[model samples]
Target: MADDSDLEKTEPASGRRLEQAREEGQVPQSRELATFILLIVGVTALYVLGRWGGHRLMHMLRTGLSFERAQAFDATGMIIALYDVAMEGLMTVAPLLIALVMATLVAPFVMGGWVFSTNILRFDLSRLNPMQGLGRMFSTHGLAELVKASLKAAVVGGVGTWVVWRERDHLFGLMLQPLEASMDEFASLVLFATLLIISSLALLAAIDVPYQLWEYHRKLRMSKEELRQESKEQEGDPQIKARIRAAQREMSRKRMMAQVPKADVVVTNPTHYAVALKYDPEKSGAPVVVAKGMDIMAQSIRELAKEHGVPILEAPPLARALYANCELDQQIPAALYTVVAEVMAWVFQLNHWIAEGGLPPEQPGSLAVPPGLDPAAGDPEAAR
Candidate 1:
């Protein structure tokens, strides 16, 4: 069952999955590439500092070996002489050490870039399980690593043998030459051998880099089921999202209905549509639709308005227009401004009459709502 599941992971890993893997400290790495870089830098540092280093080393050796008879007799003098020799050796090698250190720091970025993660630091008991350890040792990745190691050993060994064979004449001749001449020849031979080794490692690194990347991505591939699960995690479950949307809509409707009591007038289709409008001349230039709804919600608006003594005006065309075109708490369309002004005028007069105990003001007649603003006017089925 596990083998079948593994076989089913044919899709490439998504960016989110890759990022999550990186967070867990799982990233492609080629040991050969890092080793190759360090060697290359070390050799370059040696080549550049060789002549100066040789002179310093020779001076240190001569000074240490030819210490005065007086200094050799005194323990303090002997200690100072030893310290000077050690300092000279450290200075001579310092540049090459620094280069290798820098190369070590840079090598990981050659493939995976810098990743600072502490997840891998956490201890796991599974790592200590003998069965799991044996399984990992016999895994396909482990087999590939074994093959690469074998190839590298063969290449390095072959290069060393070839260099020895090629320099055999020089090696034999160095014994007969003057000490100074022999030292130069020895340095040349060492440089040549180092270059040959670097070349071999470069070839191994070039091959290993691509293979490591391929293997890393292969390990992260997603099964169809896994992809679906991941997408759900990222996007949220569809049914839950729909329920959230329904909840948000209900909350918004309740908020709109709360504004009905504050409105100056409720324009209605009497059965189908209702829009509660509010006008504040000092605050706004035109009436704003504070609440609007259809059917059951419209009935709720009417009941709330009646309870608060807000005027209910029957104007089907204006109600439909406001419901379709105007959003809550926004000014009614500019084309309906003249008609809305008339309704607002009626509202003020009706309030005045109710307070003064006089005859009630006449309701607005023939609200001149534009045909384009009325959605029902344009729909043949509604018109019928």
Candidate 2:
């Protein structure tokens, strides 16, 4: 079943999975691409050097031949002469060497940028097992690679053979020419053959790029079960997430109810809306809503306020406005500050009267609730 499940994986790999694979030093790469680029670099370097190298070699030869017998007899002069000759050779060849090294280094980074991983360094006893090794050698991936390599070799050999045969007449005629002329023609022939070989490799690389991309994705494909597990890992178990959300809502409700007792007064529409306001000179420039809710939550706030001896005033406009516009623990909008101030002043007067055992202060008449501050009052559509 496990092996069958592995075979059943057909879904495209997710971005995260591809990224993980890259981190483990697995990525789509074509050996032919590397070879092709390096061949091109080699051909280019040879052509460039061949033009300049002859003049440089002639200069070196002239310098060597012109050296005085007195300089050769002096040990220090001989050593200096040898050093100059070595430096000249190194400098002449350095660019081609640099080109080859750079081509080799750049090829792998072409697809997946540079990645350094220790995955290949890890010891795996399974790799050492003869049975597993033999199985790997005969695997579909192994067979595909072997077939691809054989095809590349055939293409290269065929192209090289055809180029050599085409140049055979020119090559044979070179023997009839002067020494320097023949050498030049030979160099051109070799360069032309190299270019033809490079052209064949370029064609192979073009095919290999897409094949490598498809094979990388195929190896990283996920099964239905694996897909679900990955999604669960990323999004979290749905049941646990729901419970966490429920707990958060409960905690928020508890915190809101606790604030009702600290509110100077709760303004309500008696049934639908409730807003508990707190004013502290040290903490706020204006009255802040410690708690506000509507419908069932509004009723809960009113009940909690009443149980805690927090004053409740029936103010439909203020309650509606506060519930619509204010957030819990946030200050009411500046437009409503004047209206809220009047209510707070009235509440303080009423409390003072009750504490003194005097007649309760006259109920505040005609509270100046701001026009268009309350959504019920402000929104024409709600009223219609």
Candidate 3:
């Protein structure tokens, strides 16, 4: 159970986004919306042009026929009329078809900003195994498809019933009209029916948009195990990383200890922490931390300082400050000025006392007897 929780925490969200994009055939909204607008505009323009041309052609045919023999308007004339109508219909649809084709050609670039891949059609025969294919074909998504089909059928059937009922009176009245009046009425009826069908289709498309988006996201969700597997592949095992970090720490400890003997003073937390400091009056205005470490490393630094006879001071605040702020070979910060000055003053005092005849030169804090030694350890009045 604990392992499962750890795995869940490490998963990346990018895989889910990629999967959703794949499942939905996700065209960017800007592109798809543009294409839809163009389609509507193209169809509407073509429809208006076709209606105008057809009306003019019919008007001309009627006028020409009125001047000819009554018997001349026969089956042969009707056949010619049908041919002319078919040619005009083809011309009307040609512009819409051309626009649709152009839209398809530009769809990918507009949708994706740029196309990075086109390898979706690469074939894999492994997907053709009968049992596996059948299983996929009958999966949960396949079941959801049945629901979509039922909803579409219900919407279309309901719209068809409503349209028939609403237009029944108009349809009946058109059938009873005289021939010239009947033709106008029939044209109007056909146009109204086409408009209703297009409107119904548009409504169906709007309803489908949300359902398709949800289905796409559901298909994109990765199982917990899949998430874990992807993370491991990307970042490697944690144990190996920990071991590498430990090796690096060991190497750093060796380098830090080598710099300790060159330090002017070693400050400490008495037992746990050790920080070595160095000062150069000619080069730096303040002391700098040359090395610092805690626990085993602190003990090693203290031992080296003792062997070299370097002064050790137990100042907890100074040691912590140096350890936290200073790096190897850097001058100490301005804020630590007073504390470091006090440590340096004591060292200078001890050196001065040793230089005079009144103090022992070898032992730092011991007194020594001297014959005829000046009280101030130099010219008495001048030292005072």
Candidate 4:
């Protein structure tokens, strides 16, 4: 059942999922790759400095063995002599230790890069569950690890055996030779054997790196249901989003209605559409549509305009055109400039007449908007 579930995860993991996994300290790493790098550094360091180290060791050994008789008799002198030998040994090995440390630092970069997540440090009780442990031990991943280990051991062991067997006669002859010459020959043989083992590891590392990356991504794959759930979590619930949109629209409507009382004139379809126009000689050369609405919203705008003593003009074509084409707080289109100019002239006239108490100024006649500008241009009922 578990295997079937794993197979069912056909979708690739998303970027967010991968980032979450990284934050949790879960990353693809091949032990073989790290081992290969460290060993390579070790072999290079040894190859370059081996002869110098060997000579140093020999000199130190000779000095320690040839200590003065008086110094050997004195405990303080003997202690100082022992310390000198230890210092010499430490100096001879310091280069190798440094090389190994540098290799350790660089090895992680070749795979998962450097990760400093603290999650891995936290203790988990699941790690102590014997049933889970047993399941992991028998899992396919565990079997693959076992196979890789066995193969590595076989390759290294086979190469070592071959080197020893091939150098069998030379090995016996070395014991009969002078110690110094024998030591050099032994060092060469050992270096040769080490290089062969490292070569085998190179092959294993090459294979393991790709396998580890593949396994990492495969484990992170999402099921269809999981993908849908993640998408929903990211985008939010549709019903809640709709409610938010509805509230936004309501607030926008209220704001539009508030601007109606400040309009210079309210052009209306008389019953269906209303668009409030405002003109500011200093701010804009042309009239701007301050508020517009249809049906119940139009009724509200008309009632609000009447309450504030703003003029209401019945111009079906102009109202429909302005309502359909013009956005709030934006100047009317250039194509309807001539008709809107006449309406503005009439508005100036009306304001003067009301202030000076003369006969009411005649409203503009047939304010004809451009063709295609009116939403209901061809409808006979809209024209009426």
- Which has the greatest lDDT? 4
Q: Which structure among the candidates has the greatest TM-score?
A: 1
Report lDDT (CA) for all predictions.
0.89, 0.84, 0.64, 0.91
User: Model 1 residue 302 lDDT?
Assistant: 96
| Pairs clashing within candidate 4 | none
180-268 per-residue lDDT for model 2 (tens digits):
67778888877877787787788888988898888889889998888888998999999989999999999999998889999999998
TM-score of 2: 0.81
What TM-score, computed on C-alpha atoms, does each candidate reach? 0.87, 0.81, 0.59, 0.86
Off by over 4 Å in 3: 1-43, 46-94, 98-116, 130-137, 140-187, 231-237, 281-283, 324-329, 345-384
lDDT of 1 at 296: 90
List RMSD in Å for every model shown: 2.9, 4.9, 11.0, 3.1
RMSD of 1: 2.9
lDDT of 1 at 292: 89
| Winner on TM-score (1 vs 2) | 1
Tell how far residue 249 is off in model 4, in angstroms: 1.3
Ranking by TM-score: 1, 4, 2, 3
Give the worst 10-residue stretch by lDDT in candidate 3: 366-375
Over the stretch 233-346, how does candidate 3's per-residue lDDT look in tens digits? Answer: 677667777888888888887777887888888987656678998888998878877889877888889999999877887765556566766787788767667667777776
- Per lDDT, what order, best first? 4, 1, 2, 3
